[model samples]
Target: MKIAIFDISNYHYTYLYSQCKIFENDRVDFYVSKFLKKSMEKEGVLNNSNFNWIVLNDFDNKYKYYKKVIKTLNNKKYDYVFFNTLQENWLLNFYFFITVNKNIKINLTLHNINIFIKCSRKLKIKRLLRTIIRRIAFYRANSYNVYGENLKIYLEKYLMKKNINKPITGIPFSIYENIKCLNDMNNKIKIIIPGTFDLKRRNYYDIYNLLKNIKNFKFELILLGRVKKDFEEEILLEKFKKFKEVILFEEYVSEEVFDEYMRKADILLAPIIKQIEMDGVLEEYGITKETGVSFAAIRYSLPVILPKEIKVMKEIEKIALVYENFEDLIRIVTKLFDDKALIQKYTEKAKKISYTYTPLKQREKLFNELKLGR
Candidate 1:
C-alpha cells in the first residue's frame, strides 16, 4: 500500500519517522518541515529508497504549502493519508476536508483531546469560527487515533456527542530508535524528568519539594529538557541549585544528548500536573491526554514515577510507580534506595513491556486496528 504522512509543524516528526520505519515494506512519503528533515537526517533515520522525504519550508505561506500538500496527495493517489496533528491548523484542515477525495482514507491523530472537545464557551467570533472548522475537519476524517486506550474512551465519548461514529484506534507512541535499556546499578539513582520545565504542564514546585526531602538519599535529579524562555521560575532554579546532585539544562538539549541522558538514567520521573489549562480549556492529564514521559519510560525500559491522578495504559501499569502525594513519592524513592533489587526488577519488567511497543509489534497492532492486511 502507498501511504503519505504529513507533519507541517515539525513537532511530530519523530512520530512520522517511526511510521516510515513501521511501514517499510510499503511505499511511504513523509512530508515534514525542513527542520525535521535535517533532524531525521542527522539521526540517520532518512536513508531509505522505499521512503521519500518531501521537505516543506517553515517560512512558506501556509496557503501555498497546504495547497501543494493536497495537490501532491491527489497526484500521487495515496492509499492512506495520515495527519500526525491537526491542532490549531483549522485552515489547512478545512482545505483537506472540502478538497480531498472521499475514497482515500483520511486518518488523524489527536495529540490533545481537550483541544478538540472542550472549546471556549466565550461569545467571541474568532474562537467560535476556529472551533467550527476544527469540528468539521474532525468529523470528516475517516478514522482517528490516540496514544493510549485510557484516553481513547474519552475521544469516543466526544465523537459520540457529535453523532459521528468512526473508528478510534489506540497506538502506543513509538520508542526511541536504536537504543537499548541498560540497568545501571549506581550509588546515586538518577531520576530524570524528560520535558520542558514549564510549571503549567508539570508541577515543578512539587519536584522542588521532593528534591528537598530526598537529599539524604543517594539519588541525582536530571532535568532533561530545556527551560522555557521568560520563565518566572528563576527562583525555583536557585532553589534547585542548592542540591548538589541535581542536574539542570538552561538551554536547548540536542537529540543525542537527550537520548544519552535517558539511557544513563535509572528512573523516569514525570511530575505532570493533573489539571492544565490550555487555550481556555481545562485538560486533565490522565483523562484528557497522555504524558510523553510514559513513552520515554517505554523507550528506555525505565520504571516511571507518575502522579496517581495520571493513569497509564494497562500494558505499562506494572512498570509505573504511581504516588499520590509528596510523602508517597518519598516512600517510593526511599524503597528504591534501600532495595536496589527493586530497580533491577522494574527494569526487567519494563523491558518486557517495552517489547510490546517495539516497531514491529506496533506495526502489527496498527495494521490490525486499521484492518490493513499484512
Candidate 2:
C-alpha cells in the first residue's frame, strides 16, 4: 500500500519515526510537515528514504497552507493518508471535505483531542463549524486510529454524544527494537526527567525543592531536553541552583544520547502536573512493556514514579511509586534509596509488565485491525 503519513506536531521524530522505520516493508511513503522537519533535522533522522519531511515557514497561517498541500498530495492517488498529530484537526476536516467531494479514502490518527477542544474554545463560530465538520469527517473517513485506549474511549464517548457512528481503533505507540536492555543498577541511582523543562507542565522546580530538602542522598537528577534561559531569571532558579544533586543538560540531545541517558538512569521521573488535556493518558494507556522511556525503564528493570490520579497508571501502581506532592516524592525517593529489596521487587515487576507493549506486537495488532495485511 502507498501510504502517506502526515505528522503535524513534529514531536514524533524522536518517538514515532523510529517505529515508522519498522513499516519499511509495508511500502509506506511518509510525509511530515509542520515542526517535524526541524525535529528530524535536529535529531539527524531527516534523510531516511521511507519519508519526506517538509518544513512550514508560515505556521501561523497553517490552515491555508495545509489545504493547498493536501490538495496537491491527494492528487497523487494514495491508498491511505495518516495524520500523526492532533493539531491537524483542521487539516483533517478539510481533507474529508475535499476527499468526500472527490470520492477518496482517508484515515486519521488522533494523538490527542484536547488541542482541538482548546482551539474550539477560542473560535466559537469556527468551533461550531468544526464540530459539524468533524462529525462529517468521522463519518467519511475509512479508519480512525487513536494512540491510547483512554483516548479512544474518550473519542468514542464524544462521538456517541454527537450520534456519529464510526469505528475507532486504539493503537499503542511502538518503540524501536534497537534499544538495548541495560539491567545493571550497580551505578549510582541515576534518575532522568525527560521532556520540556517547562515549569508550568513539568513543575521541575518542585522536584528540585524535593531533592534539596533531602540532602546527603546518593541519587542524581538529570534534567534532559530544552530549558529556557528565562528560567534562571525566575525566582525558582534560585532554589533550583541550591540542589547539588541536580544536573541540567539544557540543550536537546540526539536520540542515541537520550536513550543512553534512559539506560543509565535507575528511575525515570515523569512529574507531570495534572492537566485535564495533557497527553499523560497516552503514556499511561499506550505504555506497555515495549514502548519508549517507560519501556526502557522496564527493560532495565527500573522503577518509574508517576502521579496517583492518572486513572490508567493505576494499573501499574504496585510496581510504580505514586507521589501525592513534592513532599510525597521526597519521601518515596528516600525510602526507595534506603531500601534495596523494595527497589529490586518493583524493578523486576516493572520489566515483566512492560513486555506487552513491544513494537512488533503493537504493529501486528494495528495492521490486523486495519486489515492492511489482507
Candidate 3:
C-alpha cells in the first residue's frame, strides 16, 4: 500500500494538510509541492517533517510539472497517486494522465466542479472548448472523489451526459483525530468564526451585525484565520476596535492556538457565502469548502451555526444549527444560549458523527475503493 497525496505545497493548511496527516502511515508519503507561498512559508504553516514529505519542484506549465512529478516519484513506484490539484487545471489533467505514469492508478479529488459547470453552460466558443476538455479529463480519470454533495451530483450528470459511468464518492476532507474534543462550559456563549475572510466567500458583515444587535445574550465573537488583502471592507462594516466582545486573529493561526479557541468556544459561526463568481475557483454553495473547520467544530465537541441552504447542511443539519438570515442566526444563537442541554445534545451528536470518519477508517476505505479500480 504505497500511497501518496500529491501537490499540497501551494495552500494545504485549509484541508490538504489534514488529509496528508489523515492518510499517513509507514507506507504513505506526502508529495508536497515546493510552490512556496505566504500561507505555508509563514510562522503558522504546519511543520510537516513528522511524515515522509517529499518536496516536489514546480514548473511553468501543467505538462512540465506532471512530467517532473512523475520522474521524481519513478523510483518510489507508488501504487496509488492521489491527485489533489485544484480544478483550474481540469482542462490539462487528461493530458497529464495520458502522458505521465500511465501504469499507476490515480485518485482525483475535484475541488471545483461547479465552476466548470457554470463555464460550460455559457454559449461561447471558448467555453465550448473548455467544456469538452473538462469532460474528457473528468471521464478519463481512474477514480474520482468530491468534497461536497452538490459537486458530486454535478459530476454524476456531467459524466452521465458524456456516457461515462464512473463512481464518484463524496469524500469528507480529513481532520487530524488526535485533538481532544474540548466540551467547554463557558458562562458566556463564545462563537468563533473560522477561515479566511475572503470578500466573496464569507459573511463577516453578518457576524459583525449579529454581535452588535445581540445585547441580551452574554457572548463573545472571535475571528480566526488569515484575512485577505481587501478585508478592510469588513473592518469598516463594524469598527472592530469599538467591539469589546470581539477578538481578531487576522492571520494564519498555528494549530495549537486554533485548538485552544475550539476548546474555549461554545459554538462555531460559519457564514459561508453561497457562491463566488471567480475564475480558477469553485462557486461553493456549501460548508464542504470549509469542511476542515466545520468538522473541527465537530471534532472539538462544539456545535456550529452554518448558513442555511448550503448543500453540505443536508448532512450537517442533523448535528448543527442552520440559519437563513441574521435574524434567524440571532434566534438560533439565543436558543443555544438559553438551552445548555441542547448544546450538549448537538455536541454529543457531533462527536459521534465525527468519529464515523476517523483517519484510519477513512484512509482504509479510500485505499480499498481505489484498489477496486474504475
Candidate 4:
C-alpha cells in the first residue's frame, strides 16, 4: 500500500518517520509541514531518500493548503493519509478534515486530549467552535489513536457525547527498541531533569532548595533544555549556582547530550506539582491537566516523582514515587539512596515497563490497525 504520513506539529516527524520506515516492503512517503524549518535547518540535511521522506516548507495560503497538498498526493495515489493532530489545536485539525477531499482514510493520533478540553472550557467562544469541530472530526475519523490510556478514555467520553461511534485505541509513543543501558553505577547519585524549563511546569526553585537541604548524600542535579530569556532564568541561575553539585545546561542540547544525561542519571525527576487547577499563588507552577514529560521519563527507565492526586499517574505507580511536598520528596529520595535493594527493584520495574512500548512493537500494532502488511 502507498502510505503518506502528515506530521502537522513537525516536532515529532523525525521519530514518526523512523517508525513508518520499518515496513520496507510498503511504499511510505513522509511529509512535514514547515512549522519548524529553522530548527530542522540548524540540524542539517532534512531529506533522506532512503526513508522516502520529503520536507515541504512552503504553502500558498491557509484555505488551499490541505486541498493543494491532497490534490498533488492524489495524483500519486496514496492508499492512506495519516494526519498527526496537535494536542492544543483540535479546531485546526478539524478544519483540515472539513476542507480537504475526504476520499482517503483519515486517522488522528491524539497526543493530549486533556489540554484541548481545558483550553476549550476556559475560552467561551473557542469552546463553542471547538465543540462543533470536534463533533465533525470524531465522526469522520476511521480510527483514533492516543499516547496513553487516560486520553483514550477521554476520547471515548467525548465521542459518546457527540453520538459518534468510533474505535479509540491506546497507541503509546515509540522508543528505540535496543536502547543500551548504562552499566557504570557509581556511589554518587546523579539526578537529571531533561525538558522544557518553563517555570510554570517545573518548580525548579523548589527542586533547588530540596537538593540544597540534602547535603549528606553525594547527589548531583543536572538541568537540561533551553531556558527562556526571562527573570525566572536569571533568578534560578543565581540561586542554583551556590550549590557546587548542581549543573545547569541552559541551552538546547543535542539529542546525544540529552540521552547521555538520561543514561548517566541514577534517577529522573519529573516533580510536576498539580498547580493548574489550584488557586492563586499555587497556580504559578505550570502543572497542566495534560503533561507529556512523564512519558519520556517512563521511556528512559527513570523513577518519576509525581503528586498523589494525578489520576493518570496511578497506572505507573510501581515505577513512580508519589510525594505531596518537598519533605515527601526528600524522604523518598533519602530512603531510596540508603536502600540498594529498593533502588534495584524500582529500576528493574521501570526498565520492564519501558520495554513494552518499544518502537518495533508499536510499529507492528500501528501497521496492523492500518491494514498494511509487515
Candidate 5:
C-alpha cells in the first residue's frame, strides 16, 4: 500500500517514525517542515528505501505551501493519509475538506480528543467556525487514532453522545528499541521529567517543594524538556538553583539526548496539572487528553510516578506509583529510593509490558482495528 503521513508542526516526529517503521515494506511518504529535515536525517528516520521525505519550506507563504502540498498529494494517489498533528487552523480544515472530496481515506491521530469534541465557552466567530470545521471533519474521517485504550473509551463516549458512528482505535506508542536500558541503582536515583518546562503543563512549585525537603534519600531531578530562557530564570534557575540535585536544559533537546536521559532514568515523573485550558475549553489529563510522558515511561521501560488524577492504560497502571499531593509524591520518591527492590520490581514489570508495544505487535493491532488488509 502507498501511504502519506503528515506532521505539519513537526511535533510528532516520534509517532511519525514509528509509523514509518511499521510500514517499512510499503511505499510511504512523509510531509514535514523543512526545519526538521536535519533532525530527521540525524535520527536515520529517512534511511528506508521505500520511504520518501518531502520537506515543506514555504509554510510562511501559506497559500503557496498548501497548494504545493495538495498538488503533490493529488499526483501521488495514495491509499491512505495519516495526520500526525492537527492544529486549529482554517487552512488545515480546508485541506481536510479537499482530501475528503478526493475520496482518499484520511486518518487523524488525535493528541487532544477533547479539543475536537468540546464546545468553546467564548463562542466568537472564529471559534464557532473552527468548531463547525472540526465537527465536519470528525464526521467525515475514516477513523480516529489515540495512544491509549482509556482515551479511546472517552472518544467513543463522545461519539455516542453526538450519534456519530465512527471507529476509534487505540494502540500504545511503540518502545524505543534502539536505546539501551541504562538504569543504575548505585548512584542517586534519577527522576526524569519528560515534557517542556512550563507552569501550564506541570506543577514546578510542587516539585521544588518536594526536592527541598528531601533529606533522607539521594535523588537527582532531570529536567529533560527545554526550559524557556525567561521561564528558566523565573522558576527553574532561581527556585531550583540552590539544589545540587537538578539537571536543567535551557534549549531544545535532540532525540538522541532525550532518549539517553530516559534510558538512564530510574523513575519517570509526570507532575501533570490536572485541569488545563485547550482551545478555549477546560480539559483534564487522562480523560479528554493523554499525557505524552505516560508513553515515554513505557518506551523507556522505567517505572513511572504520576498523580492519582491521571488514569493510565492497563499495562502502565501495573507499574505506576500514584501520588495525591506534594507530601504523597515525596513519600513515594523516598520509598523508591530506600527500597531498591521495589524499584526493580516496577522496572521488571515495565519491561514486560514494553514487549507488548513492539513495532510488529503495534502494526498488527492497527491493521486489525482499521481493517486495512481488506
Candidate 6:
C-alpha cells in the first residue's frame, strides 16, 4: 500500500512516524507542512534532530501554501493519507476543497475539539457558521481517528449532532520500542512536569503548591518544557530556580538529554489545567490529553501520577496512580517513596500494558478497523 502521513511536524512526529517504522510491507511517505518548517527552526527541533523528515516549501501566504501543498500531495498518487494534526486554523480545512485525488482515502487525528465545539453560544449566528465548517471538515474526510477514549465519545456526539456519518476510531498514541526499562528504587524518585509550561494550560503554580505541602518525600522535582523567549515566562523560570528540588529545562531538549531524563525519572507529573466545560460534564474533562511524558513513562516502565478526574486516567488506570488533587497526589507520592514493592508493582504493570499502546499495535488496529490488515 502507498501510504503517506501529512503534517509531519515535531509535535505530532511520535504518533505517525513511530508506527511507520514498523510497517512490514508498505510504501510509506511523509509530507512536512510549510507551517511546520518555521516551527522547527523556532522551536529548535531542527538543530540536531535524528528525526528523518523532508521539509516543504516555506511559503509566506496561505494561498500560495495551499496551492503548492495541494499540487505536491495530489501528484504523489497515494492510496491512503493520514493527517497527524488537523484543526480549523494553523492549516484550515482547505485540504478538503483542494485535494484533487478523489480516490485517495484521507484520515485525520485531532489534538483537541475546542475550536469545533464552542464554550459559549452568545453569538447565535456565528455559532451556526462555525458548526457548519466543522460538519464539512469531518463529513468530507474518509476516516476520523481520535487519540483517547473519552475524546472519541465527545467527537461521536458532535458528529451525530452535525448529521455527519463517518468512521470514528479511537487509537492510542504509540511509544517507541527502543526505550529500555530503567527503574531504581534507591535513587531519589523524580517527578516530572513536562510539555509547554504556561499559566493558561500547564499551570506550573499548581504543581509548585502540591510540592510545597509534601515535605517528607526525598524526590527531585523537574519542570521540562519550552519556556519561550517571553519576558513574563522568563520571570516564571526565575521562580523555579529558588527551589533546590526543581530542575527546569526551559527549551527544546535534545533527544539524547530527553532519553537520559526519562530513564532517570521514576514518575511523570502531569498537572494539566481544566479549561473548557461542558453542560453536564465536570471541568476536569478539559485536561484529558495523552501527553508525550506519560507515553514515555509507560514505554520506559515508570509509573505515572495524574489526577483521577482527568478523562485519560481511565485508559491508563492499570499503569497509573490516579489521585484527586494535592491531598490525593501527596499521599500517593509518599507511599510510592516508602514502599518499593508498590513502586515496582506499578512499574511492572505499566511495562506489561505498554505493549498494547506501541505504534506498531496502533497501526495494526487502524488497518484492522479499516479492513486492510487482513
Best by TM-score: 1
Quote the positional error of residue 130 for candidate 5 in Å.
2.6
Best by lDDT: 1
> What lDDT tens digits, residue by residue, belong to model 2 across residues 1-374?
66666665656664455446445545555555656666556655556665554545644556665666677565777666665554535656555355533445566665545433323434467556665565555556676776555566676777788786766654445443434556355656777787666765566766866776767767778876666667443566566656777777556676677767776667778776555333222222332212234444543456888766544342245576778877788888888878767777886676666665555666676677667752
Task: List ranges where model 2 is wrong by over 4 Å.
Answer: 34-79, 86-103, 117-140, 174-178, 181-184, 229-233, 276-301, 314-318
Q: Please count the clashing residue pairs in each candidate, in the order shown.
A: 0, 2, 0, 1, 0, 0
Off by over 4 Å in 5: 58-60, 75-77, 87-89, 99-102, 171-174, 228-236
Clashing pairs in 6: none
Give RMSD to native, each candidate.
Answer: 1.9, 5.1, 4.5, 4.6, 2.3, 5.0
Instruction: Name the lDDT value of residue 233 in candidate 4.
Output: 70
> After TM-score superposition, what is the CA distance of residue 240 in candidate 3 from its true location, in Å?
2.9
| TM-score for each of the candidates | 0.94, 0.75, 0.80, 0.80, 0.92, 0.79
Write the residue-wise lDDT of candidate 3 on 11-99 in tens digits: 65545644654544536666666652233445233454444655645555555665666676665687767777643455455555555
lDDT of 1 by residue, 32-74 (tens): 7898788778867677787888777867877787788788887
Cα miss at 293, model 5 (Å)?
1.0
Check candidate 1 and list the clashing pairs: none
lDDT of 2 at 29: 51
Report the Cα lDDT for candidate 3: 0.64
Tens digits of lDDT, candidate 5, 197-250: 888888888888888788557778999988766644465657786788888887
The total of clashing pairs for model 2 equals: 2
lDDT of 1: 0.79
The TM-score that candidate 3 achieves is 0.80
Error of 5 at 318 (Å): 0.6
Question: Which candidate order results from sorting by lDDT in descending order?
Answer: 1, 5, 3, 6, 4, 2
lDDT of 4 by residue, 1-374 (tens): 66776774647643463345343446766566566444444444344443455555566444365556666666777776666654346655665677656676767665545433333334467666665676576557677776655556667787788777766654555454455657344666777777777776667777877877788877787877777668977787778878888888677777668767777767777766455532111221212234555566566776776666565443366787778787888888788778767767788887877776666666676777566665
Q: How high is the CA lDDT of each candidate model?
A: 0.79, 0.60, 0.64, 0.63, 0.77, 0.63
